[model samples]
Target: MGFLGFLRRSRHERTGYELYGAAVAAARDPYFYTGLGVPDTLDGRFDLVGLHAFLVIRRLQGLPEPGPALAQALFDAMFNDMDVNLREMGVGDLAVGKKVRAMWEAFHGRAAAYQAAMKAGDSGALAAALERNVWRGTPAGAAAAELARIALAQDTHLARQDLATLARGAVAFLPAARAVA
Candidate 1:
């Protein structure tokens, strides 16, 4: 199906298993993996998680079909890798932990809402949700929003391209942070 058509499909009407399957398939794809820069080893762990999260978001958005087992594997890998990377990045303290957790919760909550709207076949709602979750009021969010707009303008067929660009921007933030440090 086309991207808009795919987005309009309901997750509940489908099945967690089916969604999970798609995620898994997407996760295993070389193109997806390379786009996210998944390492052969567990080193640079946080980068891995960031990449996995990027991929997982795409998967949830209906980009692939690998199955639940692979999806679970990717999720576990991402969580473990992120924890290690966060500590190394100096987010080891409780305060930072709480903040990061809050950000994560907020992002995921919005993502779920976006998925629901997409499933319901509401293009307007889906676009609005993506704007709110990924764009809405922050510099980073604004950039993402602009990218999303460009992607949507192409008829939603550019999800992978848009996601790659988003991932690159996100990864770029780390280097910029390091330079400042």
Candidate 2:
């Protein structure tokens, strides 16, 4: 690759890392688990991060050039972070790879389900998906409606961004007030 190619790749990687940071930050908001009834557990947190990442990446897939590359890099970054997190949590090195691999597959499946629900263009679809995935078959209880509303709102927020801005992989999540948070 030439110098310009190198430069572009660097920029793409940076954007991906930035987008990953944004996704994780949004996922870390206490509202989802504390207020929205998402279980405050490892799987729940990973699902939330994957959800936000998918939201932005779905938008990225529509772009022409670096968008797809950046989208992929962002996905990698999420898993890379997860790998490090596992290590920090004292997961054995040999087992960490297996765990991360499982997480990647699970996240991919979740992303597909979420994208399909979002594409259905109804809050009901998203609600049902969340109720199934996040709540794990049981009803989401009082937080179901609010969580659904936020997902819909976040989707709209993503839709409103210009393709160029989105290509930069910098997504801003809309913050909603919650009774618990």
Candidate 3:
């Protein structure tokens, strides 16, 4: 993280950090864990973050200019955070890579499922995906429905956002007003 750090200091990189932070914040909202019964475990938190990040990265898809680069930066920030978390959890340095790879696979699979649902404009499909990935088949009751509503709304909201704002590392997430505990 010395001189090599200079390579990571672009606007896209900065924007990625900002967006990822926003995603983490959204995931950490108490409603998701308490109301939605998201387990409040490490796997639960990762699923929430992965869900949120997928929304943002999906928004950046197919956009010209800084969109792709910013998305890639956001991805890097996520994996970097993952690396730090694993280390902090007492994972030996040698085993971190394998664990992270597993995480990457899970995230990638989730993203693919979400993308297909979004492309099909199918709420049921999205909810099914969430049921498997986020809820782990336990069923979150009304809160699960609320999360699906939130994701669709957030996706629409993010789509309406100006690229200039996103390029500056600025993202505004909609409130979870539709869902209550």
Candidate 4:
């Protein structure tokens, strides 16, 4: 099947398990690994990030009312993975670390508000949350933007230049993107 066909068929699954399985399979295969330049080692955190990204996309597509705690957990997972990559690359001393942390906290706060709005069926609140601090200029913002694009299929709304810059940064730190793609 074509890529779009796979996505459509996968979306039809009634349970998250099927979607999660497909996502994990995709993440493990060389197709995604080569595209993202992720290492084959089980210890590589990028693989986990990729899997979580797929899971988040599936959950959002299913429109399941994931509680605030669940959302927070996912956010924390992604943030932690990015932090690990940053530290390994010796970016811990850069101001980018502080900026990235602040951006993550802001994103988490907005995401919680968004989840509450979703549960309340409050469109206004959702819109407001989306509008506020959706993209801060930091590594976390780039990761969040990538996740948002993956989850929402709304890539056009993200800052492309910033995303590219962040992707380059990640590639430099991870040393896999250059080799993968």
* lDDT for each candidate structure: 0.40, 0.79, 0.85, 0.39
**What TM-score, computed on C-alpha atoms, does each candidate reach?**
0.41, 0.84, 0.91, 0.33
Top lDDT model: 3
Candidate number with the higher TM-score (3 or 4): 3
Clashes of 3: 0
Largest TM-score belongs to which candidate?
3
User: Model 2 — TM-score against the truth?
Assistant: 0.84
The C-alpha local distance difference test score for the whole of candidate 1 amounts to 0.40
Error of 1 at 139 (Å): 9.9
- Give per-residue CA lDDT, model 2, range 40-114, as digits (tens): 888788878888888878877866777788788888788878999999999999999999999989888887777
Which regions in candidate 2 have their CA more than 4 angstroms from the true location? 1-11, 167-169, 178-181
Candidate 3 per-residue lDDT, tens place, 1-181, comes to 7988887576577678898999999888887777678779998899989988999998887678788888889998899899999999999999999999999999999999989988998888888888788888887666666777788998988898878888887887776665332
Between the candidate structures 1 and 3, which one is better when assessed by TM-score? 3
Q: Write the per-residue lDDT of candidate 4 for residues 1-181, one digit (tens) a residue.
A: 6867866432223223333333344345453234433344533333343433433442343333442223334444455555765677677557657956774665456556655654575655544443343322222333333333332332121212232222221111112222222
Which digits, one per residue and each the tens of the lDDT, describe model 1 over residues 1-181? 6768978543333333333333333334442223323333433232223323444444434433333333344444444445556788777568656755764565466556655654575656654555444334323343333333332332233233433332222211112112112
Off by over 4 Å in 1: 1-66, 93-100, 138-181
Q: What is the lDDT of residue 75 in candidate 1?
A: 46
Span of 10 residues, lowest total lDDT, candidate 4:
167-176
